[model samples]
Target: MDKVNNFELGIIGCGNMAKAILSGIFSSGFLKPHQVTAYDVNPETAAATEYEFNIRMAGDLTNLTLNTAKLLVSVKPKDVGAVTDSIKNVFAPGKNTIISIAAGVPAGFYEKKLNAKAPVIRVMPNTPVLVNKGIAVISKGKYADKEDLEFAVKVFAGLGEYVIVDEKLQNAATAISGSGPAYFFLIFKLLVEAACDLGIKIEDANKLVLDTMEGSAEMLKKFNSDAGHLIKMVASPGGTTEAALDIFMKKQLDKIIKAAVNGAFNRAEKIQDKILHGD
Candidate 1:
C-alpha cells in the first residue's frame, strides 16, 4: 500500500535503461533523488528498482499518473498501449510531460493513445548510456514545446550527446546512433579475433584492438579528418596496412556497411506499434 505522492518524474517501466537514465540524471544533479518514483505492473520489479534508487514505488498506474507532474515511459513497444490505456483517464493534460525511450515507437502514437493533450517526447538512447557515453536522439510530438524539449535534453545531457531531430527522421537516426554501437562493437570483436588468429596472445589482442579503436577515433577528431583521409594516411603504398586494406576493398566493405545501415533503417520503421485513432 504505497502512498500516492507528487513526483516530478514517474517512471512507467523500471528496467535497465530506466536505471541508467536515473543514474545519469542523478549525476547531472538536475532532479533530486526524492523527486522521482518508479511504477511497474510487477510489484516485485517496482520494489527492486525502489531499493536501488531509494525512490518510492507506486502500487498502481493510476496513482502514478495522477500524482507525477512528469513521466518517463520506458516500456517495450508492444506493452505501450496497455500502459497508455491504464493512464489516459488519469493523465493530467497540461501538467504531465511524458518522455518515452521505447525503441521504434514514435511520439505520435503515445499522443494519440493518451488523447489528453499532454506533451509527448520520444527518445532513442543506446545502451552506452549505462556507462554515460550514449547518444540520445530526441524528437518532439505535435504537442511538445520548447519547455518539454529542454527538460528532455537536460535529462540525457548528463549521459552523453543528444540531438533533436524531425520525427520523420527518427527511424534513420535510430539506425545510425541507436543501432550504431552494436556495429562498432562487432567490428572491434572481429578485429580482436583476427589478431588472435595472427598468433597474438588473447590478452595482448584485446588490449591492442581496443586501444587501436580508441586511439583511431581520437586521431580522427584531433586531425579534423574523415575516416577516408585517415585510411589513406595509414595505408602507405606497398605497406602492411595497404595489403590488408586491399583485401577489404576487394570485399567491398563500404558497400557492405551501407547495406547493413540501410537494413537497420528499414527495420526501425517497421518495428513500431503504430496504432492510429480511427484505425
Candidate 2:
C-alpha cells in the first residue's frame, strides 16, 4: 500500500473555487500541475479544467482518493454528505487528510461521515481567492493535529492569507472573511452610485472609487493602526471627511454595520445547523 503522505494533492471538485486554488498553487510553484489531480461530477467542467490547467482528471472520487494523500473537498455544503460517502471507503485512517472549503460544513461532519480517526480540516475562503488575494480561515477536526492544520495552511497560503481558528469560531470566520468581499463590493457599488449622483460621470466614478479603495487598502496594509484609528486620522476635526463621518455617526452607521455582520454570522450558524441536522 502506498504511504498516506506519499500521494499527491487531490481536489474533489472543479468549480470556480477549486479552479482558483489550483491556479494559485500552480502559479506559486508550490505544486506542479501533474502533482495534483481533480474530480468533478460534471464531465464538461472536469474536461475544461484538465485542458486549462493541464492537470490530470480522476475518473471518479475513488480514483482521486487513491492517488492523493491530501484531499480538498470543494463541493457545496449540501453535497458534502454524498461526496464523503462516495470517497469514505478510500480514506485511510491516520493517512489521508481531508480539507473542506464548503461553507457551513464543519470538520466534525466529515469526520462523522468518514472514519472517526480521519483527519479533517474545515476552511472558509472568500471569493477574492479567485484573484489570489483571499483570506481563508481554517479549523481542525477531532483527529487532526498541528501538522495536519499546517499542511492545510501551506496549501491555502498559495492562494493568499490564512488564519487558524478554533472549530467553534469557524462560522464567525465564515461570516467575516468568507463573506467579507461581497460586503466590500456592495459598499463600493454604493459609493460609485453616490459619486454618480453627485454629478460625476459613471466611468469616472468607478475609476475614482476603485482607485480610492485600492489606496485605502494599501494604507491599511502599510499602517499598524486599526481601522478606527485610521479613520480618525483621516477625518480631521472639521474636515470634509469629518463632516461625512459626523453624519454617519448620527445615523448610527456602526450599529447598522454591526447588525449586518451579525446577520451574516447568524445565517452562517443557521446554515451549519441545517447541514448538520437537516433542519
Candidate 3:
C-alpha cells in the first residue's frame, strides 16, 4: 500500500519515543518504511533515524505532503512553538493531519499557533511503548474527523492498548496512562527498598516483588477482577497480608495515592496552561 492509503507521515522529531512508535507501526505492517520520513533540527539525528528505520530524510515538512500526509509532531512540549512556527510557515493546509505526541500541550495550542484549521490529533504514550506494552490515549482536534481518529488508533494499536477520549479529558487521561508508569516504578522501587531494609537480599527481594507484581497484574487481566476483589482474596481476616494492608490503611495510603494522582492531574493542567499562556 503505497503511502498506506496515501497517508505519508512526517515525523518532526527523531527521539527515542518517536523511534518506538516507528518500530511498532513498521512491525505491525501499518506503514511501510518508505511511507514515512524523519525530520530533526539536528541533521545527525535525522540521518541516524533515516538509516536505522530505512525511511526517507525529509528536507522539509512540505515534502511529506507530495502524496498527502499525516505529519506526526513527535517533539517535546518545550519545542512545540519552534516546530509549530516552522510547520505553520511551510506546511500545507488540509490534505494532512497533524498528529502530536507531545504531552500536556493540547491540539488547540498547535492550531492556535498555526493560526489555521489544520487537522490535529493528540496522543499521550508512556515509556512502556518502548517495550511494546504501552497504552496511548488519543483525542481529536476540531478539524479531525472519524477517519482521523480511526487511523490514529490503528497507528498506536501495535504498541499495546489504546483508548480514545474527548479532547477535554485528554489531560486527565494523560495524568494516568501517560504519567502512570512512573507511579508504578516508584512504588516498585519502594517495595524493593522496604524489603531490603527488612534484611532480604536485594536479588531475592527483587524476585519477590517482581514476581508478585507480575502475577498480580496477570490476575487482574486474566480474571478481570477489580483490585479490591484481589486484595480481599489475598488478605484473609487476620493474615499477614491483612496486617500490612491495615498498616497501609492506617497510614492513609489510599488518600495519599488519591492526592498524588490529583496532583499529577493538576500539574498536567498547569503544563497545558504554560504551553498556551507561557512561563
Candidate 4:
C-alpha cells in the first residue's frame, strides 16, 4: 500500500460533510492519522474537528496545503470566495486535486477564484453521507485531468455511491440528492405521527416506521421491483392497505411530490443565478 496513495488529505472547512469524510477516511484506514490535515475559520471548530479525528489542524487555509495534498473544500457556497481567496495565492497547480461539496456553486467560480489551472472536481452529496450511506454526484471542470477525476470519485466512493454527471444537470442533482434527504425525512415523520395517533407509543411508532422503511428499501434492492409493484405486494385488494392507498391517490400524492421536487430544483437554479449574476 502506498500509505500516501490515500494522499495527505486536506479539508478547508470542518462542516458536517467535511467531518463525515474525515470520519470515513480515518475509519476505513484509507489514511493514517498523520496523513490528514484540516483548517476552519472558527478556531474552536478546527480544534474540535482535529481532536475528534486525531489529525493535524492548521490555523488558516493558506497553511492547510503546506504539505502535498488532495484538498476537499467543504465550505458554504457564500464563504467559498473567502476560503479560495485565502489559499489561491499559495495553492500549487497540478500537484493537488481540489474537491468542492458546496451546492449551487459552479466550477467557473472556483476556476476564477483559484487563479490557476488547478484540477477542480465539483461534487453534490446528500446529508446521509454522515451515516456513510450518501449518494454523491460529481463532475469535472476543464482543469481536471482524467486521473484527478478518478481519484475524486474514489474518495467519494469511500463514503458512498457516486455518479458522473454533467455540469448542466447539477441543479437537478441538488434537488434530487442534496435536498432529497429532507423530503424523505419529512415523509418518515408524517408516518410516525400517524402511527402515534393510532395509540401506538412514541417509541413503538418510531421502531415501526424505521423497520418498515428499512424493510421496504431492502426488498426493493433484492427484488428489483418497481415502487408500484412493491405497493401492490403489500396492499391486498379491498383491504386496510387499499383504504389508505385510496386516500393517498385522492390527495394527488404523486403530483404533489413531483411539484415539491421541481420547486426545489427551481429554487436551486434561482440561487445559483442570483449568486453568479445577481439576477
C-alpha TM-scores of all predictions: 0.93, 0.95, 0.94, 0.91
- The runs of at least 3 residues in candidate 3 whose Cα sits more than 4 Å from the true structure, single-residue gaps closed, are 1-7, 65-68
The candidate scoring highest on lDDT is: 2
Backbone N/Cα/C clashes per model: 0, 0, 0, 0
Tens digits of lDDT, candidate 3, 115-154: 5687889998888989999999899999888888888898
Report the candidate with higher lDDT, 1 versus 4: 1
**Candidate 3 clashing pairs?**
none
Give model 4's TM-score versus the native structure: 0.91
Tell me how far the alpha carbon of residue 85 in candidate 2 is from the true structure, in angstroms, after superposition. 1.7
Identify the superior model by TM-score, candidate 2 or candidate 4.
2
Candidate order by TM-score, highest to lowest? 2, 3, 1, 4
Among all windows of 10 consecutive residues in model 4, the one with the lowest summed lDDT is: 1-10
Query: Which pairs clash inside model 1?
Result: none
For candidate 2, lDDT tens digit of each residue in 70-156?
Answer: 899999878889998898888886768889999998876777788878888888888888888888998888888888888788888
Of models 3 and 4, which has the larger lDDT? 3
Q: List the residue pairs that clash in candidate 4.
A: none
Query: What does each candidate score in C-alpha RMSD?
Result: 3.3, 1.7, 2.2, 2.7
- Give the Å shift of residue 109 in candidate 3: 0.9
Task: Give the per-residue lDDT digits (tens) of candidate 1, residues 1-279.
Answer: 553447888888988899999898998899988998889888788888888889888888888888887789999877888988898887766777789898887777777778746698989999889899899999998898898899999989999889999988988988899889999999999999999998999999999989998899899988886878888889899999999988998999989999999999988766763344322
